[model samples]
Target: MNQTRYPELAGKRVWITGSSSGIGAGMAKILAQQGCKLVLHYCRNETGVQQTLQTVAELGAEVEVVWGDFADYASLENVFHQAWSAFDGLDVLINNAGIVTKSTALNDNTGAAFNRTIAINLQAPYRLSTAFAKACIDAKQPGVIINNSSIHGQQTCEWFSAYAASKAGLDAMMKVMAVEWGPKGIRVNSLAPGVVPVERTAKILAEPKMAATWTKTMPLQRFGHVDDMGWATAFLISDSAAWMTGSVLTVDGGLIARGGYPARE
Candidate 1:
Protein backbone atom coordinates (compact mmCIF):
# COMPACT_ATOMS: atom_id res chain seq x y z
CA MET A 1 0.00 0.00 0.00
CA ASN A 2 1.22 3.45 -0.84
CA GLN A 3 1.63 5.78 2.11
CA THR A 4 0.31 9.32 1.66
CA ARG A 5 0.41 10.69 5.17
CA TYR A 6 3.43 8.71 6.37
CA PRO A 7 6.89 8.40 4.86
CA GLU A 8 6.19 4.89 3.59
CA LEU A 9 9.09 2.85 4.94
CA ALA A 10 8.05 0.00 2.71
CA GLY A 11 11.00 -2.02 1.49
CA LYS A 12 13.35 0.02 3.64
CA ARG A 13 15.64 -2.43 5.41
CA VAL A 14 15.43 -1.94 9.17
CA TRP A 15 17.54 -3.66 11.81
CA ILE A 16 16.46 -3.55 15.45
CA THR A 17 18.19 -4.87 18.57
CA GLY A 18 16.36 -5.83 21.78
CA SER A 19 13.26 -6.49 19.70
CA SER A 20 11.98 -9.55 21.55
CA SER A 21 9.64 -7.53 23.75
CA GLY A 22 8.76 -4.20 25.34
CA ILE A 23 9.53 -0.93 23.60
CA GLY A 24 11.62 -2.63 20.94
CA ALA A 25 8.75 -4.93 20.02
CA GLY A 26 6.34 -2.03 19.95
CA MET A 27 8.56 -0.04 17.61
CA ALA A 28 8.98 -3.11 15.42
CA LYS A 29 5.22 -3.27 15.00
CA ILE A 30 5.00 0.42 14.16
CA LEU A 31 7.75 0.04 11.57
CA ALA A 32 5.94 -2.93 10.11
CA GLN A 33 2.79 -0.83 9.80
CA GLN A 34 4.77 1.54 7.62
CA GLY A 35 5.75 -1.43 5.38
CA CYS A 36 9.38 -1.77 6.49
CA LYS A 37 11.46 -4.87 5.92
CA LEU A 38 12.51 -5.84 9.43
CA VAL A 39 15.51 -7.54 11.00
CA LEU A 40 14.52 -8.28 14.61
CA HIS A 41 17.47 -8.86 16.94
CA TYR A 42 16.82 -10.44 20.30
CA CYS A 43 19.17 -11.63 23.03
CA ARG A 44 17.85 -14.77 24.82
CA ASN A 45 14.10 -14.77 24.21
CA GLU A 46 13.90 -16.90 21.08
CA THR A 47 10.37 -18.20 21.68
CA GLY A 48 9.13 -14.67 22.30
CA VAL A 49 11.01 -13.26 19.31
CA GLN A 50 9.43 -15.88 17.07
CA GLN A 51 6.06 -14.61 18.19
CA THR A 52 7.10 -11.06 17.31
CA LEU A 53 8.28 -12.25 13.90
CA GLN A 54 4.94 -13.95 13.30
CA THR A 55 3.04 -10.77 14.10
CA VAL A 56 5.35 -8.71 11.96
CA ALA A 57 4.99 -11.18 9.09
CA GLU A 58 1.23 -10.77 9.29
CA LEU A 59 1.73 -7.07 8.70
CA GLY A 60 3.24 -7.76 5.25
CA ALA A 61 6.77 -7.05 6.40
CA GLU A 62 9.73 -9.00 5.16
CA VAL A 63 11.00 -10.40 8.42
CA GLU A 64 14.19 -12.06 9.68
CA VAL A 65 15.19 -12.97 13.24
CA VAL A 66 18.79 -12.83 14.42
CA TRP A 67 20.13 -13.83 17.82
CA GLY A 68 23.30 -12.15 19.03
CA ASP A 69 24.22 -11.46 22.61
CA PHE A 70 24.93 -7.77 23.07
CA ALA A 71 27.91 -8.63 25.25
CA ASP A 72 29.45 -10.79 22.56
CA TYR A 73 30.99 -8.86 19.68
CA ALA A 74 32.21 -11.97 17.84
CA SER A 75 28.66 -12.85 16.85
CA LEU A 76 27.78 -9.39 15.54
CA GLU A 77 29.17 -10.03 12.12
CA ASN A 78 27.05 -13.14 11.89
CA VAL A 79 23.92 -11.13 12.60
CA PHE A 80 24.83 -8.48 10.06
CA HIS A 81 25.61 -11.04 7.45
CA GLN A 82 22.52 -13.12 8.02
CA ALA A 83 20.23 -10.13 7.68
CA TRP A 84 22.22 -8.57 4.90
CA SER A 85 22.12 -11.73 2.84
CA ALA A 86 18.41 -11.20 2.37
CA PHE A 87 18.28 -7.41 2.24
CA ASP A 88 21.53 -5.96 0.98
CA GLY A 89 20.32 -2.40 1.12
CA LEU A 90 20.39 -1.26 4.73
CA ASP A 91 18.54 1.89 5.73
CA VAL A 92 17.86 1.95 9.47
CA LEU A 93 19.52 0.43 12.51
CA ILE A 94 17.80 0.69 15.92
CA ASN A 95 20.11 -0.13 18.83
CA ASN A 96 17.42 -1.06 21.33
CA ALA A 97 18.97 -4.09 23.06
CA GLY A 98 20.29 -3.34 26.55
CA ILE A 99 20.52 -4.88 30.05
CA VAL A 100 20.37 -3.33 33.52
CA THR A 101 20.73 -5.17 36.83
CA LYS A 102 19.63 -2.80 39.55
CA SER A 103 22.10 -1.71 42.19
CA THR A 104 20.98 0.69 44.88
CA ALA A 105 24.35 2.31 45.44
CA LEU A 106 27.88 2.51 44.11
CA ASN A 107 28.96 0.38 47.07
CA ASP A 108 26.42 -2.19 45.97
CA ASN A 109 27.97 -2.29 42.51
CA THR A 110 30.45 -5.09 42.02
CA GLY A 111 33.15 -5.06 39.37
CA ALA A 112 31.31 -7.87 37.57
CA ALA A 113 28.01 -6.02 37.68
CA PHE A 114 29.42 -2.75 36.37
CA ASN A 115 31.27 -4.57 33.60
CA ARG A 116 28.12 -6.38 32.50
CA THR A 117 26.12 -3.18 32.46
CA ILE A 118 28.64 -1.28 30.37
CA ALA A 119 29.23 -4.22 28.04
CA ILE A 120 25.60 -4.56 27.11
CA ASN A 121 24.10 -1.10 27.39
CA LEU A 122 27.00 1.10 26.36
CA GLN A 123 29.73 -0.84 24.60
CA ALA A 124 27.56 -3.16 22.54
CA PRO A 125 25.47 -0.40 21.02
CA TYR A 126 28.60 1.54 20.14
CA ARG A 127 30.09 -1.53 18.47
CA LEU A 128 26.85 -2.41 16.70
CA SER A 129 26.38 1.13 15.45
CA THR A 130 29.90 1.11 14.12
CA ALA A 131 29.28 -2.19 12.40
CA PHE A 132 25.97 -1.04 10.95
CA ALA A 133 27.35 2.32 9.92
CA LYS A 134 30.25 0.76 8.11
CA ALA A 135 27.93 -1.59 6.24
CA CYS A 136 25.58 1.19 5.25
CA ILE A 137 28.44 3.39 4.19
CA ASP A 138 29.89 0.61 2.11
CA ALA A 139 26.50 0.06 0.56
CA LYS A 140 26.46 3.77 -0.13
CA GLN A 141 23.00 4.22 1.36
CA PRO A 142 21.72 6.71 3.87
CA GLY A 143 21.06 5.08 7.24
CA VAL A 144 19.52 6.02 10.56
CA ILE A 145 20.51 4.59 13.95
CA ILE A 146 18.21 5.31 16.89
CA ASN A 147 19.58 4.31 20.25
CA ASN A 148 17.07 3.13 22.87
CA SER A 149 18.30 5.29 25.73
CA SER A 150 16.96 6.47 29.08
CA ILE A 151 16.09 9.71 30.83
CA HIS A 152 18.70 8.81 33.43
CA GLY A 153 21.29 9.53 30.77
CA GLN A 154 20.37 13.16 31.23
CA GLN A 155 19.92 13.00 35.02
CA THR A 156 21.42 11.12 37.91
CA CYS A 157 19.56 8.40 39.78
CA GLU A 158 20.05 7.67 43.46
CA TRP A 159 20.73 3.92 43.27
CA PHE A 160 21.08 3.19 39.62
CA SER A 161 24.62 4.35 39.07
CA ALA A 162 25.60 1.46 36.77
CA TYR A 163 22.64 1.98 34.49
CA ALA A 164 23.19 5.72 34.53
CA ALA A 165 26.82 5.49 33.57
CA SER A 166 26.11 3.16 30.65
CA LYS A 167 23.40 5.44 29.32
CA ALA A 168 25.63 8.46 29.74
CA GLY A 169 28.16 6.81 27.46
CA LEU A 170 25.41 5.95 25.00
CA ASP A 171 24.28 9.57 24.89
CA ALA A 172 27.83 10.73 24.24
CA MET A 173 28.37 8.13 21.51
CA MET A 174 25.21 9.10 19.63
CA LYS A 175 26.23 12.75 19.57
CA VAL A 176 29.67 11.92 18.20
CA MET A 177 28.22 9.84 15.38
CA ALA A 178 25.74 12.50 14.36
CA VAL A 179 28.72 14.58 13.38
CA GLU A 180 30.79 11.69 12.03
CA TRP A 181 28.08 10.05 9.89
CA GLY A 182 26.04 13.09 8.86
CA PRO A 183 28.22 13.67 5.83
CA LYS A 184 27.38 10.18 4.69
CA GLY A 185 23.60 10.54 5.14
CA ILE A 186 23.46 8.44 8.28
CA ARG A 187 21.53 10.14 11.06
CA VAL A 188 22.28 9.04 14.61
CA ASN A 189 20.08 10.02 17.56
CA SER A 190 18.63 8.64 20.77
CA LEU A 191 15.20 8.36 22.40
CA ALA A 192 15.73 9.18 26.06
CA PRO A 193 12.52 7.59 27.36
CA GLY A 194 11.35 7.87 30.93
CA VAL A 195 9.42 5.08 32.65
CA VAL A 196 7.71 3.00 29.98
CA PRO A 197 5.12 0.48 31.18
CA VAL A 198 5.28 -2.86 29.38
CA GLU A 199 6.56 -6.40 29.84
CA ARG A 200 9.79 -4.86 31.03
CA THR A 201 8.14 -2.75 33.72
CA ALA A 202 4.61 -4.16 33.93
CA LYS A 203 5.22 -6.23 37.04
CA ILE A 204 6.96 -3.37 38.78
CA LEU A 205 4.26 -0.92 37.75
CA ALA A 206 1.52 -3.36 38.75
CA GLU A 207 2.78 -3.34 42.30
CA PRO A 208 0.19 -1.08 43.81
CA LYS A 209 2.45 0.50 46.37
CA MET A 210 5.20 1.21 43.89
CA ALA A 211 2.76 2.47 41.26
CA ALA A 212 1.04 4.70 43.76
CA THR A 213 4.32 6.02 45.04
CA TRP A 214 5.69 6.80 41.62
CA THR A 215 2.40 8.21 40.42
CA LYS A 216 2.31 10.59 43.32
CA THR A 217 5.94 11.36 42.92
CA MET A 218 6.00 11.56 39.14
CA PRO A 219 4.84 14.90 37.79
CA LEU A 220 2.56 13.39 35.14
CA GLN A 221 1.10 11.05 37.75
CA ARG A 222 1.12 8.28 35.12
CA PHE A 223 3.45 5.79 33.53
CA GLY A 224 4.25 6.04 29.82
CA HIS A 225 3.31 3.28 27.39
CA VAL A 226 5.80 1.51 25.12
CA ASP A 227 3.81 2.77 22.15
CA ASP A 228 4.48 6.33 23.24
CA MET A 229 8.22 5.80 22.93
CA GLY A 230 7.92 3.67 19.81
CA TRP A 231 5.89 6.17 17.81
CA ALA A 232 8.23 8.99 18.66
CA THR A 233 11.13 6.82 17.45
CA ALA A 234 9.28 6.08 14.24
CA PHE A 235 9.00 9.78 13.56
CA LEU A 236 12.61 10.51 14.46
CA ILE A 237 14.03 7.80 12.20
CA SER A 238 11.75 8.69 9.31
CA ASP A 239 11.96 11.47 6.79
CA SER A 240 9.65 13.50 8.98
CA ALA A 241 12.68 14.08 11.16
CA ALA A 242 15.02 14.37 8.22
CA TRP A 243 16.59 17.44 9.70
CA MET A 244 17.01 15.90 13.15
CA THR A 245 20.22 14.21 14.34
CA GLY A 246 22.33 13.90 17.48
CA SER A 247 19.21 14.93 19.40
CA VAL A 248 18.07 13.35 22.66
CA LEU A 249 14.28 13.47 22.48
CA THR A 250 12.55 12.91 25.81
CA VAL A 251 9.09 11.37 26.18
CA ASP A 252 8.66 11.49 29.94
CA GLY A 253 5.29 12.57 31.26
CA GLY A 254 6.40 15.96 32.56
CA LEU A 255 8.86 14.14 34.77
CA ILE A 256 11.83 16.19 33.60
CA ALA A 257 9.88 19.40 33.17
CA ARG A 258 9.68 19.98 36.93
CA GLY A 259 12.29 20.19 39.66
CA GLY A 260 14.21 16.98 40.33
CA TYR A 261 13.00 16.78 43.91
CA PRO A 262 10.35 14.13 44.42
CA ALA A 263 7.18 14.63 46.48
CA ARG A 264 7.96 14.76 50.18
CA GLU A 265 7.13 11.76 52.28
Candidate 2:
Protein backbone atom coordinates (compact mmCIF):
# COMPACT_ATOMS: atom_id res chain seq x y z
CA MET A 1 0.00 0.00 0.00
CA ASN A 2 2.94 2.31 -0.50
CA GLN A 3 0.96 4.47 -2.96
CA THR A 4 3.34 7.01 -4.35
CA ARG A 5 2.05 9.38 -7.02
CA TYR A 6 3.26 10.41 -10.45
CA PRO A 7 1.91 12.58 -13.27
CA GLU A 8 3.19 10.50 -16.16
CA LEU A 9 -0.44 9.92 -17.20
CA ALA A 10 -1.26 13.52 -18.01
CA GLY A 11 -2.87 13.98 -21.42
CA LYS A 12 -3.52 10.29 -22.03
CA ARG A 13 -6.77 9.02 -23.54
CA VAL A 14 -8.77 6.62 -21.37
CA TRP A 15 -12.09 4.81 -21.84
CA ILE A 16 -14.01 3.23 -18.98
CA THR A 17 -17.24 1.30 -19.30
CA GLY A 18 -19.80 0.98 -16.47
CA SER A 19 -18.93 4.47 -15.33
CA SER A 20 -22.47 5.00 -14.13
CA SER A 21 -21.72 3.93 -10.56
CA GLY A 22 -19.84 1.94 -7.98
CA ILE A 23 -16.16 1.14 -8.63
CA GLY A 24 -16.32 2.57 -12.13
CA ALA A 25 -17.54 5.95 -10.88
CA GLY A 26 -14.85 5.95 -8.21
CA MET A 27 -12.15 5.10 -10.73
CA ALA A 28 -13.43 7.71 -13.18
CA LYS A 29 -13.01 10.39 -10.54
CA ILE A 30 -9.46 9.36 -9.70
CA LEU A 31 -8.35 8.88 -13.31
CA ALA A 32 -9.84 12.16 -14.39
CA GLN A 33 -7.80 13.96 -11.76
CA GLN A 34 -4.69 12.28 -13.14
CA GLY A 35 -5.15 14.35 -16.34
CA CYS A 36 -6.62 11.81 -18.73
CA LYS A 37 -9.24 12.56 -21.36
CA LEU A 38 -12.13 10.28 -20.50
CA VAL A 39 -14.62 8.31 -22.58
CA LEU A 40 -17.45 7.26 -20.26
CA HIS A 41 -19.72 4.39 -21.26
CA TYR A 42 -23.08 3.43 -19.79
CA CYS A 43 -25.41 0.64 -20.79
CA ARG A 44 -28.81 1.77 -19.45
CA ASN A 45 -28.37 3.96 -16.42
CA GLU A 46 -29.19 7.43 -17.66
CA THR A 47 -29.12 9.03 -14.24
CA GLY A 48 -25.92 7.27 -13.26
CA VAL A 49 -24.26 8.27 -16.52
CA GLN A 50 -25.24 11.88 -15.98
CA GLN A 51 -23.83 11.78 -12.48
CA THR A 52 -20.55 10.35 -13.76
CA LEU A 53 -20.22 13.00 -16.45
CA GLN A 54 -20.99 15.70 -13.90
CA THR A 55 -18.41 14.28 -11.55
CA VAL A 56 -15.83 14.21 -14.35
CA ALA A 57 -16.67 17.76 -15.31
CA GLU A 58 -16.11 18.89 -11.74
CA LEU A 59 -12.60 17.49 -12.06
CA GLY A 60 -12.09 19.75 -15.10
CA ALA A 61 -10.91 16.97 -17.37
CA GLU A 62 -11.79 16.65 -21.04
CA VAL A 63 -14.66 14.16 -21.10
CA GLU A 64 -17.25 12.63 -23.45
CA VAL A 65 -19.87 9.98 -22.91
CA VAL A 66 -21.49 7.34 -25.11
CA TRP A 67 -24.42 5.00 -24.78
CA GLY A 68 -24.27 1.41 -25.96
CA ASP A 69 -25.68 -1.90 -24.87
CA PHE A 70 -23.13 -4.45 -23.70
CA ALA A 71 -25.15 -7.14 -25.44
CA ASP A 72 -24.72 -5.22 -28.67
CA TYR A 73 -21.13 -4.83 -29.85
CA ALA A 74 -21.87 -2.96 -33.07
CA SER A 75 -23.52 -0.18 -31.08
CA LEU A 76 -20.34 0.25 -29.04
CA GLU A 77 -17.84 0.51 -31.87
CA ASN A 78 -18.67 4.05 -32.84
CA VAL A 79 -18.38 5.25 -29.25
CA PHE A 80 -14.79 4.09 -28.94
CA HIS A 81 -13.88 5.23 -32.42
CA GLN A 82 -15.34 8.66 -31.78
CA ALA A 83 -13.56 8.86 -28.47
CA TRP A 84 -10.34 7.79 -30.14
CA SER A 85 -10.85 10.44 -32.79
CA ALA A 86 -11.53 13.12 -30.24
CA PHE A 87 -8.50 12.24 -28.19
CA ASP A 88 -6.36 11.37 -31.23
CA GLY A 89 -5.30 8.01 -29.73
CA LEU A 90 -6.59 5.68 -27.08
CA ASP A 91 -4.12 4.74 -24.34
CA VAL A 92 -6.27 2.84 -21.88
CA LEU A 93 -9.47 0.81 -21.86
CA ILE A 94 -11.12 -0.09 -18.53
CA ASN A 95 -13.61 -2.88 -19.10
CA ASN A 96 -15.49 -2.17 -15.91
CA ALA A 97 -19.03 -2.57 -17.16
CA GLY A 98 -20.52 -5.82 -15.86
CA ILE A 99 -23.66 -7.16 -14.23
CA VAL A 100 -23.94 -9.56 -11.30
CA THR A 101 -26.94 -11.74 -10.60
CA LYS A 102 -27.82 -14.07 -7.73
CA SER A 103 -28.59 -17.50 -9.05
CA THR A 104 -28.15 -20.41 -6.69
CA ALA A 105 -26.18 -22.50 -9.18
CA LEU A 106 -25.95 -23.18 -12.86
CA ASN A 107 -28.58 -25.85 -12.38
CA ASP A 108 -30.85 -23.41 -10.61
CA ASN A 109 -30.27 -20.58 -13.02
CA THR A 110 -33.16 -19.70 -15.31
CA GLY A 111 -32.14 -19.67 -18.93
CA ALA A 112 -32.65 -15.89 -19.17
CA ALA A 113 -30.70 -15.11 -16.01
CA PHE A 114 -27.85 -17.37 -17.01
CA ASN A 115 -27.55 -15.92 -20.47
CA ARG A 116 -27.80 -12.29 -19.37
CA THR A 117 -25.24 -12.72 -16.63
CA ILE A 118 -22.65 -14.24 -18.91
CA ALA A 119 -23.29 -11.79 -21.72
CA ILE A 120 -22.83 -8.64 -19.69
CA ASN A 121 -20.25 -9.80 -17.18
CA LEU A 122 -18.11 -12.06 -19.35
CA GLN A 123 -18.76 -11.30 -22.99
CA ALA A 124 -18.80 -7.51 -22.75
CA PRO A 125 -15.24 -7.22 -21.48
CA TYR A 126 -13.97 -9.86 -23.88
CA ARG A 127 -15.53 -8.14 -26.88
CA LEU A 128 -14.45 -4.66 -25.88
CA SER A 129 -10.90 -5.75 -25.09
CA THR A 130 -10.62 -7.38 -28.51
CA ALA A 131 -11.90 -4.32 -30.31
CA PHE A 132 -9.85 -1.85 -28.29
CA ALA A 133 -6.67 -3.91 -28.46
CA LYS A 134 -7.04 -4.48 -32.20
CA ALA A 135 -7.44 -0.77 -32.81
CA CYS A 136 -4.39 0.04 -30.70
CA ILE A 137 -2.28 -2.61 -32.41
CA ASP A 138 -3.35 -1.60 -35.90
CA ALA A 139 -2.42 1.96 -35.08
CA LYS A 140 0.90 0.73 -33.67
CA GLN A 141 0.35 2.46 -30.34
CA PRO A 142 1.02 1.21 -26.87
CA GLY A 143 -2.06 0.74 -24.66
CA VAL A 144 -3.45 -0.94 -21.58
CA ILE A 145 -6.68 -2.82 -20.84
CA ILE A 146 -7.72 -3.36 -17.24
CA ASN A 147 -10.49 -5.87 -16.69
CA ASN A 148 -12.63 -5.65 -13.55
CA SER A 149 -12.79 -9.14 -12.20
CA SER A 150 -13.97 -10.09 -8.71
CA ILE A 151 -12.88 -12.11 -5.67
CA HIS A 152 -15.55 -14.55 -6.79
CA GLY A 153 -13.44 -15.19 -9.85
CA GLN A 154 -11.04 -17.23 -7.72
CA GLN A 155 -13.61 -18.15 -5.06
CA THR A 156 -17.39 -18.06 -5.03
CA CYS A 157 -20.65 -17.61 -3.15
CA GLU A 158 -23.17 -20.46 -3.19
CA TRP A 159 -25.74 -18.52 -5.20
CA PHE A 160 -23.24 -16.63 -7.32
CA SER A 161 -22.17 -19.31 -9.74
CA ALA A 162 -22.98 -17.34 -12.87
CA TYR A 163 -21.44 -14.15 -11.55
CA ALA A 164 -18.29 -15.85 -10.29
CA ALA A 165 -17.88 -17.93 -13.39
CA SER A 166 -18.12 -14.86 -15.57
CA LYS A 167 -15.34 -13.13 -13.69
CA ALA A 168 -13.26 -16.30 -13.76
CA GLY A 169 -13.66 -16.39 -17.51
CA LEU A 170 -12.63 -12.76 -17.77
CA ASP A 171 -9.42 -13.43 -15.84
CA ALA A 172 -8.70 -16.51 -17.89
CA MET A 173 -9.03 -14.45 -21.06
CA MET A 174 -6.79 -11.73 -19.65
CA LYS A 175 -4.04 -14.31 -19.18
CA VAL A 176 -4.21 -15.35 -22.83
CA MET A 177 -4.38 -11.80 -24.20
CA ALA A 178 -1.48 -10.64 -22.07
CA VAL A 179 0.70 -13.23 -23.74
CA GLU A 180 -0.75 -12.64 -27.21
CA TRP A 181 -0.43 -8.86 -27.07
CA GLY A 182 2.73 -8.41 -25.02
CA PRO A 183 5.06 -8.32 -28.01
CA LYS A 184 2.67 -5.89 -29.71
CA GLY A 185 3.09 -3.24 -27.00
CA ILE A 186 -0.30 -3.79 -25.35
CA ARG A 187 -0.87 -4.76 -21.72
CA VAL A 188 -3.93 -6.59 -20.35
CA ASN A 189 -4.56 -7.36 -16.71
CA SER A 190 -7.46 -8.07 -14.38
CA LEU A 191 -8.30 -7.18 -10.77
CA ALA A 192 -10.18 -9.28 -8.25
CA PRO A 193 -11.86 -6.97 -5.79
CA GLY A 194 -13.05 -7.71 -2.27
CA VAL A 195 -16.13 -6.06 -0.74
CA VAL A 196 -15.98 -2.48 -1.85
CA PRO A 197 -18.52 -0.12 -0.23
CA VAL A 198 -20.98 1.16 -2.81
CA GLU A 199 -24.57 2.37 -2.99
CA ARG A 200 -25.63 -0.49 -5.23
CA THR A 201 -24.10 -3.05 -2.90
CA ALA A 202 -24.95 -1.14 0.26
CA LYS A 203 -27.17 -4.04 1.16
CA ILE A 204 -24.06 -6.10 1.76
CA LEU A 205 -22.42 -3.34 3.82
CA ALA A 206 -25.52 -2.85 6.01
CA GLU A 207 -24.96 -6.25 7.55
CA PRO A 208 -22.23 -5.27 9.97
CA LYS A 209 -21.67 -8.73 11.37
CA MET A 210 -21.38 -10.31 7.96
CA ALA A 211 -19.12 -7.48 6.81
CA ALA A 212 -17.00 -7.89 9.95
CA THR A 213 -16.73 -11.61 9.41
CA TRP A 214 -15.57 -10.93 5.88
CA THR A 215 -13.00 -8.43 7.17
CA LYS A 216 -11.62 -10.67 9.91
CA THR A 217 -11.50 -13.38 7.30
CA MET A 218 -9.00 -11.78 4.95
CA PRO A 219 -5.26 -11.77 5.61
CA LEU A 220 -5.42 -7.98 5.68
CA GLN A 221 -8.16 -8.25 8.31
CA ARG A 222 -10.32 -5.75 6.42
CA PHE A 223 -12.41 -5.26 3.34
CA GLY A 224 -11.39 -3.06 0.40
CA HIS A 225 -12.40 0.41 -0.71
CA VAL A 226 -13.18 1.77 -4.16
CA ASP A 227 -10.40 4.28 -3.70
CA ASP A 228 -8.02 1.41 -3.00
CA MET A 229 -9.11 -0.21 -6.24
CA GLY A 230 -8.70 3.09 -8.05
CA TRP A 231 -5.11 3.44 -6.92
CA ALA A 232 -4.19 -0.15 -7.75
CA THR A 233 -5.77 0.17 -11.20
CA ALA A 234 -4.15 3.55 -11.72
CA PHE A 235 -0.76 1.99 -11.08
CA LEU A 236 -1.42 -1.02 -13.32
CA ILE A 237 -2.55 1.20 -16.18
CA SER A 238 0.23 3.69 -15.69
CA ASP A 239 3.80 3.51 -16.88
CA SER A 240 4.83 2.43 -13.38
CA ALA A 241 3.60 -1.09 -14.07
CA ALA A 242 5.14 -1.29 -17.53
CA TRP A 243 7.02 -4.50 -16.81
CA MET A 244 3.88 -6.27 -15.65
CA THR A 245 1.26 -7.84 -17.95
CA GLY A 246 -0.97 -10.89 -17.97
CA SER A 247 -1.25 -10.46 -14.21
CA VAL A 248 -4.44 -10.95 -12.21
CA LEU A 249 -3.84 -8.77 -9.18
CA THR A 250 -6.14 -9.50 -6.26
CA VAL A 251 -7.01 -6.25 -4.56
CA ASP A 252 -9.14 -8.20 -2.15
CA GLY A 253 -8.37 -7.76 1.55
CA GLY A 254 -6.17 -10.80 1.04
CA LEU A 255 -9.30 -12.92 0.87
CA ILE A 256 -7.93 -15.23 -1.82
CA ALA A 257 -4.45 -15.12 -0.30
CA ARG A 258 -5.79 -16.47 2.99
CA GLY A 259 -7.19 -19.40 1.00
CA GLY A 260 -10.90 -20.13 0.80
CA TYR A 261 -10.83 -20.99 -2.86
CA PRO A 262 -13.09 -23.90 -3.67
CA ALA A 263 -14.49 -22.74 -7.02
CA ARG A 264 -11.11 -22.39 -8.63
CA GLU A 265 -9.79 -25.58 -7.05
TM-score per candidate, chains pooled = 0.92, 0.90
- For candidate 1, the per-residue lDDT at 231 reads 82
TM-score of 2: 0.90
CA lDDT of every candidate = 0.83, 0.82
Tens-digit lDDT string for candidate 1 (1-265):
4222345666788888888998889888888888888999887898779988998898788998888886876777777777666676578888888876687765664577778888989887887788888988888788899998898898866767889999988999999999999999999999988888877679978899999976886777898887787688778877789999999998888777675776775
Model 2, range 120-143, lDDT digits (tens) per residue? 888777777888888998898998
Error of 2 at 66 (Å): 0.8
Separate clash counts for every candidate: 0, 0
Superposed Cα RMSD, model 2: 3.6
Compute the lDDT for candidate 1: 0.83
User: How many clashes would you count in candidate 2?
Assistant: 0
**Which parts of model 1 are misplaced by more than 4 Å?**
1-5, 105-110, 262-265
Q: After superposition, how far is residue 47 of candidate 2 from its true place, in Å?
A: 1.8
